[model samples]
Target: MAAVVRGMFALEPAQHRAESCQPGGRGDASGGETQPVESGEIPRCLLVGPKGSGKTALLFQYGLSLVRQGRRVTFISHETLHTMPLHVAGATKPDPLSLKQLQILYLNTQEALLKFLSSIHTQAPLPTQAPLPTAILVDDLDYYVSTAQTAESAPVVARLCAYLVDAAYFISNKLSEDKTSVAGRILCPVVATVAPPGDRTALQWYERFLTSVWEVKGVAGQPTMYQLSDASSAERAPLVVTYEIGGTLRVLDVQDLNEPMEGDD
Candidate 1:
């Protein structure tokens, strides 16, 4: 999922697999598992785009990529598409068995989503099994946050972000502190897709808690052409990724896209 646009956002979900190997790292004597708060876990990400700009497809691809690498992912959505076309960066077809590693949880309401997130924190301390998941992927976060009764209230958005951040921290630190990781330190990142609010003010409210942001915009003339912009960094201009969405996210050379970006929503 992250393999194609990863270059755009520089999201390396694979880092969680190698955190223990970092220099000067200390872990259990057997595996040198990364210690709590010691490993540099991948940052949680927010993929923002208008409808049909390929945000959900890209997310599914990213999670598939992580699963292919022997990592586990928990995908949550209030309304997952019944027929979402999915494939990894270079795969000819999405593997059927890989879906096992990608656990899909249908959280169908705003309250359900919040309660599920809160439950992750309150769950019994890190289990004595495999390490924590590599990533938590949420689709259509705007629906979850904006459909609440108090959607316009600041606390609505604030609490959601807080819950997500805490989950990332808990998955990263609590599991490692318990020395339950087989691959050293535990690293978990949360990635979610959101439809950009029509009002820029509302969009800004959501970004306040985002560690990374990638926006997908469509080409005006070419239906297959989409430009992905990495706005995660304020220090530099957002890097743009123009690509054609097929079975895979095939990158189109920058010189080929002569059309201006417009709406696909």
Candidate 2:
């Protein structure tokens, strides 16, 4: 949905807009050639950072935004979430009733997580009366990929990513198939996070599946302060959003003039 902005993935609004990744193309009437038309775009975002960079808080904020728009969210994690984020920086506080729309699921091991995704990919199971998720957030996807203790983890990890996009993203696309506007008046996005790996070489293997990459960087001169920026962009200086999560999540400042001014709320 055009209403989608930074809340989608804490990304630079201008770069990740729906118009940026429109799928398919249309005939160019003037040139009789196929040209890309503005259709619905699927935003596949990957959030990379180290432990305690507030990645979970950012993802929760994104899920809360979808809930407010009347969409359901499924947050999958390796362990049970101990706390729910409230009063996040640059985000609206979600009410009790609305928060119910955000469901949490825990799959504690890589094998278990992969199995769940594979099952859902084929069956697309849903709770008795609940609607399909408009957003699927995997907190620390690395837990389901990098921590595998075997040599065959690569293919399994790749499968996890596939089912995530196929099953999770398919939920949004199927809902938007007729509506044109994705379910919940927003693009059904798959937003996931991963702690930066010890060996940087492992990164390229994952980047192939991501459409956009946002990084959480600790502010050099400040403690308990961090910035989120799009590391996928190679063209221009990316927009940087500075935020804090000491007690309550609060945005202290932002940099980069190229970010869009409208639809930011």
Clashing residue pairs in all predictions, respectively, total 6, 2
Segments in model 1 whose C-alpha atoms lie over 4 Å from true places: 1-4, 7-34, 38-42, 125-132, 151-153, 236-238, 246-249, 254-265
**lDDT value for model 1:** 0.64
Let me know the TM-score candidate 1 reaches against the reference structure: 0.76
Q: Candidate 2: deviation at residue 228, Å?
A: 1.5
Q: For this target, which candidate reaches the highest TM-score against the unseen true structure? A: 1
How many Å off is the CA of 86 in candidate 1?
A: 4.0
For candidate 2, give the lDDT of residue 151.
70
Error of 1 at 153 (Å): 4.9
lDDT of each: 0.64, 0.63
CA error at residue 168 for candidate 2, angstroms: 3.0
